[model samples]
Target: MPDNREARAAARTDMIMRTTLALAQETGYAKLSIEAVAARAGVGKHTIYRRWPSKGLLFLDSLLSLNEPALDYPDTGDVMADLRRQIYAAVDLLTGPQWGPLYQALVGEAQHDPAVAAGLGERFIRPQTDKTVARLRAAQEQGQVAPGFDLDLAMSILSGPLYFRFLISQEPLTRDYVDRVLDALFAGMGPRGPADAPASA
Candidate 1:
């Protein structure tokens, strides 16, 4: 039930997205360009421009297209257990063979480019953190977390260490690491004594 032009357009879009991601993974952000993408996709620069205004937009779109089905926000009631699952899934996605370099490239580019930073934060990072925060809020309501616990901080506590290991430490992000991160976050977010504080390790 699809029109000829629409079908062709969809196919072309798929071709362009795949080519864009392939080039991004191969050459990284600095060398990637609309011309290169169009050339690799066997399309015209004008064709790409008609769909996306800038190479950055195309880059973000390509990442989002690939990211759509991977990370599902969890809310299965048991706060620590759910967070563990979510964090492990995130670590897997970010440190996995196919997506790891691409994720690192996008995040690294975001550090240098304001547009990329905004795009990645607004499109990718914010949504993920928001989902995590929502999950925390639910846990707070259920009395699993402290009343004054900061959802934003909780999100950072959960995700920050993974990204640190992933991007900064350049170390292996493993299941054990995820477990430790969750353990530390739980200790911090759970009911604490007067002398309690978040564990950095």
Candidate 2:
């Protein structure tokens, strides 16, 4: 059990993270200021500075903390099904009510800041991609997926449509959209079988 002091510290951190997200949502990150976040969080400026060196770092932490740990992926011995579950989780993050705008802001920031770009790639994007890659490799080994399929390429193929929808198309992402993407990618790359049909026309 955490001591009272420790629990209070944890609560303060959570407050800060939530406040930062709300602030960013209301006014863009470009206009965010440490003084404002500290005032909103009800903490001193030094307290915020003690935890993160810059606003970008603080935003990164807030984004990364939103993820329910990666080990939450289910094995289920069916790699395609497992991948679908994971992809659905991604869809939830991209299109879900709380985190979607945060993701959008980070992507936009990454366009200008090389450091933010690198951090977002390493902290946010790659971990998610790596999970899919591992699932693909496991599926291949289990003989559920083609042995010759390229994991990186396959991951890209699986993700390309989702990113296109989320970033490029500027439309609301839906469960139906996710289903179509999974169906299309898996039909093309998954092992040939009677269970498979021509992907959604």
Candidate 3:
């Protein structure tokens, strides 16, 4: 357990992150200010600065903290099944009430603000991409993915439709759609062979 001072500091930091996400969702990140977060979080501005150099970092930290817990992938040995499960769980959370507003606000603001864009990519997008790539490579070692497949393209195939639906199409994201995405991706990347033959390396 944390000592009194450490416990208080942790509590204060959580408050700041919670407040930043809420205010940013309501006011939008482009309009959110450190002063407002401090005011809402009930902490001095200096307390925020002590950890994050600016409001963008503070906002990014809040997003990273929120995403970290949900990002863990439980490998069930069947790579495709695991990927589908993880993607659906993520889509559910991103589309759900608790975090969707902040997600949309951050993404909307990132388009107009380069710092926010970089922070979002660095903190959120890149980690997810890298993690997926690592899993794809592992799947290849197990002969689940063709050796010729590009890991980057694999990441895109997994995420492209999900984001397109989330940010553009605004269609309902279903588990069936998630399964289809992976199935199509695998078919394209799978080995070339006769219809009844096994895939070759």
- Among the numbered candidates, top TM-score falls to 1
TM-score of 2: 0.79
Instruction: State each model's C-alpha RMSD to the native.
Output: 4.4, 5.0, 3.7
Expressed as tens digits, the lDDT of each residue in 120-164 for candidate 1 is 888888888778888889899998999998888888777778888
Name the runs in model 2 displaced over 4 angstroms: 1-14, 44-47, 66-71, 192-201
Model number with the top lDDT: 1
lDDT of 2 at 157: 85
Ranked by lDDT, the better of candidates 1 and 3 is: 1
Candidate 3 residue-wise lDDT at 178: 89
Put down candidate 2 lDDT per residue, 1-201, tens digits, no spaces.
Answer: 999999999999998888887898899778887889999988998999998778887887777785444534689998767877877777776787667877887888788877778888997678878877887788888887876888899888888888888998987777787778778877777787655556777
Enumerate residue pairs that collide in model 2. Answer: none
Residue by residue across 46-122, what tens digits does model 3's lDDT show?
Answer: 99999988777787789778657366566777788778777888888888876766787778768876888998898
Compared with the true structure, all predictions reach lDDT values of: 0.83, 0.80, 0.82
Once fitted onto the true fold, the runs of candidate 3 whose alpha carbons sit more than 4 angstroms away are 1-10, 25-31, 46-54, 194-201
Worst 10 residues of 3 by lDDT: 66-75
Candidate 3 achieves a global lDDT of 0.82
